[model samples]
Target chain A: MFFLSPFELKGDIDSVFERDPAARSILEVLLCYPGLHALILHRFAHRLYLARIPLIPRLISHGTRFITGIEIHPGAKIGKKFFIDHGMGSVIGETTEIGDNVTMYQGVTLGGTGKHSGKRHPTLGDNVVVGANATILGPVHIGAGSRIGAGSVVVRDVPHDSTIVGVPGRVVRHKGEKTYDVSLEHGKLFDPIESLNAKLEQKMAHLENRVAELEKEKRRSA
Target chain B: MFFLSPFELKGDIDSVFERDPAARSILEVLLCYPGLHALILHRFAHRLYLARIPLIPRLISHGTRFITGIEIHPGAKIGKKFFIDHGMGSVIGETTEIGDNVTMYQGVTLGGTGKHSGKRHPTLGDNVVVGANATILGPVHIGAGSRIGAGSVVVRDVPHDSTIVGVPGRVVRHKGEKTYDVSLEHGKLFDPIESLNAKLEQKMAHLENRVAELEKEKRRSA
Candidate 1:
């Protein structure tokens, strides 16, 4: 009996189901879900972290990561109002602290510099949006209100009143855009997809070419 | 009720619980799992492929690949009695009709070749063992009673009662001291993952290095 009921998890579970057009029913996610197991473990770990169990709490987190590839370091203090989207290959490193109201996409790595110790991994101030395949490395502090672009490999500190993009991300747009408090309105993260659609498109195009070639060959045979 | 119980659906439900050294309780896996959802979706697609849903099945299979790096083509008729190791970034292509009694490692890609389109994927014969990160491409066939080496990129059709290894896999050994009925012993298919343990170890090693360097630097500073 953790603080939240397992039934309450249905809301987020429903979100996943809503996206997956293939899912037949809800009972499927409830009975045999490792995701559910992970949630329960995180809750226990979070409680242990709050109770100041110290190293053991972090150990639990690492064990979870080993099985799941979704790492949430115990030292990285996350607020209660937190949820992950399409949680695969997502790494949250130790010493990286996140504030209230943050949503991250898939393949988002909250990692450290190659050789830096003590407070490496970004100190994400409140209301931060990290795009997919984004790597935020080093001990750099990101301002409270910032949006990191997809596939960005950030190394330095990001200013609060700006939007960052590209490798070694730089501010792309921030002149007149409203500094919308991410906490006030942190909408759902993007659809948890990497390049599935693109690959399908590629295959479809390949098929089209093949069909055309086949037709040409048929004409030759004719 | 759904078609199959979550406990029975091996692909998506956290079936890891069945393994030794697994989690103590079911609650721990749900919240933090990164690959559970993908695995679940994979089970459905894999089954659909068995039912022969044609292109839609493959499309949905690609969708699973996009969401999770693990790809199991719907057209590749795989047998039961198999397991995926790490199950990340693994690709099993179309036209690869696998026999019973086979196993594969992680980062393994069973793909097709130039636009010939006649049973594009490899037909893996029975009682075969493919190592981690091995790539078996083209419509070429792999004979029954064979073992493919890890990190090998295979292109040619393998001989029966043989062992292939290396970049363009060369026969390492033939007549590997074993005698079993290839017809009766079924093949198995799943994602390769045992090879990925090195990555986890590397992460731990990198962390150790940082701590060791910090201690040395602290001594110098003092």
Candidate 2:
């Protein structure tokens, strides 16, 4: 059994209401939210892990995973007011560290790439929002207030207050600007691939026109 | 209680061994493998759904979701020999259809757009392989032998024998050719964003060189 402070528990509950529009009541959040369930379980498991209690901590972690579908390693360190919305298939690695007021959507992975030992997972700063199915691999740092777009694969460090979108994520906005609301509207995010293809089409048209003019000039001279 | 044919049961069990290299033995697969569990449960639920049993089928679906972390609506039609590896966070919407020998990875969503009535989900053809975290929305048809890459969001129809990649997926390989093996190696898939960025750099360089030459020629003539 794990003993949790009422203040900390209230803070976690408050976070769900602050971030999620779908949260109807405190009773509903308490009974239905798997994210909150997993967090509470992890806190207990983490304490056992810190106490050097071996198999029990791992067993509790495994049972929590079976129930919640969210895998949080007992060795990971998570701060206050952490909220994971629809947290299915979300994985937090052993060496990972997450800061306060962090929000993550479903299928997000804070994972490692190689088999190297120490500090092999990501460290997320305060107020970081990671969208659905976003994978952040290796020992990278995601700065405070950064928003990672949905379905993005990030393998490198991201700066503070940046908006990261696309595969092998490129920093699209870094002006410390905030947009829209806290709720993640994945469809509204900028389509970088579409934008690039458009630019490519424009350039190709210009080159074709220039080549045609050059051909006509040569013909006239001849 | 739901009765399943022994032949269909064997086929489903065999699929785990065929598709996933991690399957050690029959006992391991039967005890583990949430995909197999979810599929078996879905078959039972689907039978009840066709019989027009009201809340029980939906209740079974909900219970299955709780255990497996894979949500398959009772109204969805699935095919034979289908395999879902690491089935967490996968959702199959109502009116979604699948063909024989189709394989799906973790976090895949066969979903719909808008609140339209009939056939709002995707229909996948035989031999289609959808990778991890890939989302196929709307009532689009995925042609036979097509491979969808990891983390790709596809909203439009894809042609046969095509390899789709990137966000809002583009057909990267449409030659009716196959590559590597069946098991999805997400890291090895063609990165269209990187390729486009390289092409853009080359085009910009060529344009800059041509502009410099034209300026020098004009200066000489003057």
The per-candidate TM-score of the B chain, in the order shown, comes to: 0.60, 0.90
lDDT of 1 by residue, B1-75 (tens): 314455445433333443213555555544333345444555577677677564555556546655556666555
Model 2: per-residue Cα lDDT over B1-222, one tens digit each? 466789898999998887654345686677667789999999999999999999998999999888888899999999998998666889999899999888887789999999878889999998898876889999999998888876788999999878887777888877656653532433335667778789887977788579657656655754
Isolated chain A: TM-score per model? 0.61, 0.87
The DockQ scores of all candidates, in the order shown, are 0.03, 0.15
Model 2, position B65, has a per-residue lDDT of: 86
Whose DockQ is greatest here? 2
Off by over 4 Å in 1: A1-40, A114-117, A160-162, A175-222, B1-222
What TM-score against the true fold does each predicted structure earn? 0.41, 0.64
Index of the highest-TM-score prediction: 2
